[model samples]
Target: MNTIKTIYLILCIFAISFLSRFWMSEWKWYAQFLRLKLKSKEEPDVGFDNKRDADPNKILQEADDIYQLISSTKPLFDIPPFERSTSAHNSKYYIMNPTEVHSTGNLLYTYVETYDYQGNRKTTGGDFFRARIYDKKTLTAAVGSITDFNNGSYLVTFPLYWEGTVYISIKLQYSSEMVSLIHRLRDIDNYRMGFRGIFLSKNYKEMTKCHFNLTFTGPLCDLYYHNSGIKWMCEKPKNLSCENLSSLEYYFNEPSLSEAEKKFDDRKNVLKEIRPVGASSVIVKKQGSNINLPKCQSHPLTYTNSTGFVQNHTWISSLCQVKRFRTSERVIQCIKGKKIYLVGDSTIRQWFEYLVKIIPTLSKVNVGRNQWYSEKLAVDLTNNIYLQWRTHGLPWHPGVPLMLPDSPSAVSLINNIYGGKEFITVICLGAHFTRYPLKVYLETLIHVRNAVKRLLGRSPDTTVILKNGNTRTPYKLLLDNDWLTYELNQAFVAAFMGMNVSLVDAWDLTAAYESAELHPSEEVIKNEVDVLFSYICPNID
Candidate 1:
């Protein structure tokens, strides 16, 4: 009887321990699954226009309503998906540097470091580090927010210019002893691996720190750091032939990865991989000199006190011409009495902001605070047209037609607005569809097209431009570090045709910045908007 009792207790303990570990993993997985499901199902909420004399509860109710509005509205823009590589034994780390350029606005710079065992199918351990930035200056506010974190990427608007250099670092800690146990269990397969980090700083100064440490279970094979920013060590400490970083050529033994994979220079898919071109690199291609476009009256664009921007005096089809398009006048126009509406995503906001700065001839114009949801400018011109922007988030299917009054509120809203005047609706939506399957994206477009058809019944002059989705580093989050901007750009342009809508090839214009940083300079913006401008009003000011 005693022996039987002992066996029963032992079995119960083993079962409980086994279930506990599984429960931990399962709980973690369920939490992640719910979060992702919510993220994928994006819907923004509308805002409440609360009255001035509303009581405290009314305000609170309005706040709740606003939350609902934000919840239902679609996100026009989103960060890249932070997905782990499927390889079980490997681990990947992402390096992010937030940048704010005047032309490119604000953006997060991302670089990836991947580590793997000799032969493993799974990537593991790699986790997110939690940290924050503090502003010591006058604002007395926290500069960074954990709420802005979407998956692995975080949000940062342009830090105020006066804030000075921001003191920023990371806080990371290992979770669960199982990872440590796994490391010990796979001792023979482990090998030393190095990662090259890339990031951009607010200051143009090239100096930066590489903070790291290593744990070893075996004999210390080597230890060295070079001025060339390369480090390596061999079995014997006295022997140091690895200092010649320039001569070091990385060759991949496995056929699955490319030659560029060995070296950290795998970021080029559109352009050939070129070594880091310093300040003195010569330009090999000539810009538009032979184009028949009229030359600008203003030679080498002079800065204007009125607009606080450089004015281009010429009209050329090349990148040089477009970046400088804002030089003389805003290239957008509202017909004397009709509403000119710019609808779709935040990328359209760039166009909206550009139009606001350039169009000076309008007599009466009312501007409101900009929201990611939408922006409106009532222009009193020969044609009293309200220049309006209506933003929709992902799953931007304009909704079903003639289905029911409450079925598609978004489409119903557009139909309600389309009562009388011939509205000029310029739409460019599709950037938020990276994670969404292409079939789903196309189906959404079909719904949108049907809505447009119902609203503006085949009016020839009623212009509708469907700009192909803007291009970005698609697999950046996956550490597939191949920046194939041109290839992807070409693919986007070729893909969208015969939809009976005017196609603006914004991606092609953006390809000029292939070798440049992730952000587009003034040149790239001009090129993109020029296509729209040419489609709308081709004549130079």
Candidate 2:
């Protein structure tokens, strides 16, 4: 009888202990949730007027005039004058000083010098230059930095990634071109810039004179100008625009000049002579070398973290493993029983488009032709998975159809989400707001942060990811250049600090690549998606 009584007592104590631990865990989670909620409440409220004062017609006209100026391919400024030296000079105008071969994960430096037509040294302090290293065997490439000393010298550094012989290429930016870039980065009212290149269809190649403004959004250029007040459309071409657009090589090619003209060698004269000539090769040893490579880790954002290196190509995250859902079955398995909400700009739309193409059964049901901001959905009924995409509220490009009353803001969308282990939400915003004041972007982000905090509070198990803006190729007329995007990305990182959200550092990934494309190439997008999936399924390989 005593043994039975003792057993009962022991069982009673065990039950109480188990309950105590479970309740304690719940209490801690609740405390964190409450803290986040209070922090969100403390954020300042931001509001925007629904009515805009600008006329779309005038903007479109200005865009047309700017397009004509850029297409003419004329120099925007006069060349600088340079005096020819009587003494003999180095025949090689520019010399690339080579550095020792490096292994994977090591930093390699390549130095360059700028000289005039007479072989006299020239200063490129104000000029912008970019360097790239191309792997000979894989044909893959990585971008490098060119730090100018205001003298005749510049230092270029590359983070060695691949093995084998690597060829280096340097592209220099003219001072006049630098002015346009600076304006695009700083000036909020500059609507004349931002068109990178025109897209052309094989069948409609005859349409050369097209005016592009904020309202143009079709894949093919349309002739209708009555309603929009713009005759030409800077359409997003269905096929690759590489063939229709002018190549970088053509823009930066060495200009042919008379012998007498070459002898003068002023700034104007030197500009014609200066070009990115071929340089010596640098070898990168294989990945298994004895060199101690730094392991990539995510650091918490703090006030003291330096923003200077945000644009640097060297700070790449190595933790991202390549993930490919090559088959529809694999995608279905990964996304099954999950609800995903993708909110942001056309860049996020790219992800939606990629999935639609890969998954044969995932058909897009068109909500309406005029409803560009409407919710787009793709469902796999058998797996019970739901995917949705919607544009975030206001300051979006005029190209997007105005939102309906039913449309929700990013904050509202996040708040509406019944977050759970099965829910994933991605927020991406930047390119559209580059032309607006910096304060506007920050206000929007604060509201978004509040919404995210509230959602996480309600459903602590929910996953939220933020995709930062990517780099765009440097084009004089392109308003949404890389420098502006880089600054906006910095603002984005700042706004989301101390929040429980995952950041896919697209800026670093995009800048590190050989291509400075606004809409990065498929290889880059694939890597981004893979990184995203890594967060979604960390337990998977």
lDDT of 1 by residue, 450-487 (tens): 44545545343455555544445544322211112222
Candidate 2: regions farther than 4 A off: 1-99, 112-128, 145-155, 173-181, 188-279, 287-317, 368-371, 398-401, 473-478, 497-499, 508-524
Which window of 10 residues has the lowest lDDT sum in candidate 2? 246-255
Every model: Cα RMSD to truth: 27.8, 19.8
Instruction: Name the 10 consecutive residues with the lowest summed lDDT in model 1.
Output: 301-310
* Reference-based lDDT, each prediction: 0.33, 0.53
* TM-score to native of every candidate shown: 0.37, 0.58
List model 2 lDDT by residue over 1-541, tens digit each. 5654554455455544433543464454435434432443345322121121023443333334322321222222333432322111221212232334567776565555565446666653444444566654564566665444545555566666667787665654333233333433344333433333343355553222222344555554432311112232344455555346321010111333345434332332111222433335766788664444332222332222111111222332443333555567877777878888998877777788788888887878776444445678888787877788977755444343232332446766776798999999999988776664444465566557656766776787888888989877534223445545655775676566556667777765665564567677766676667666656765554
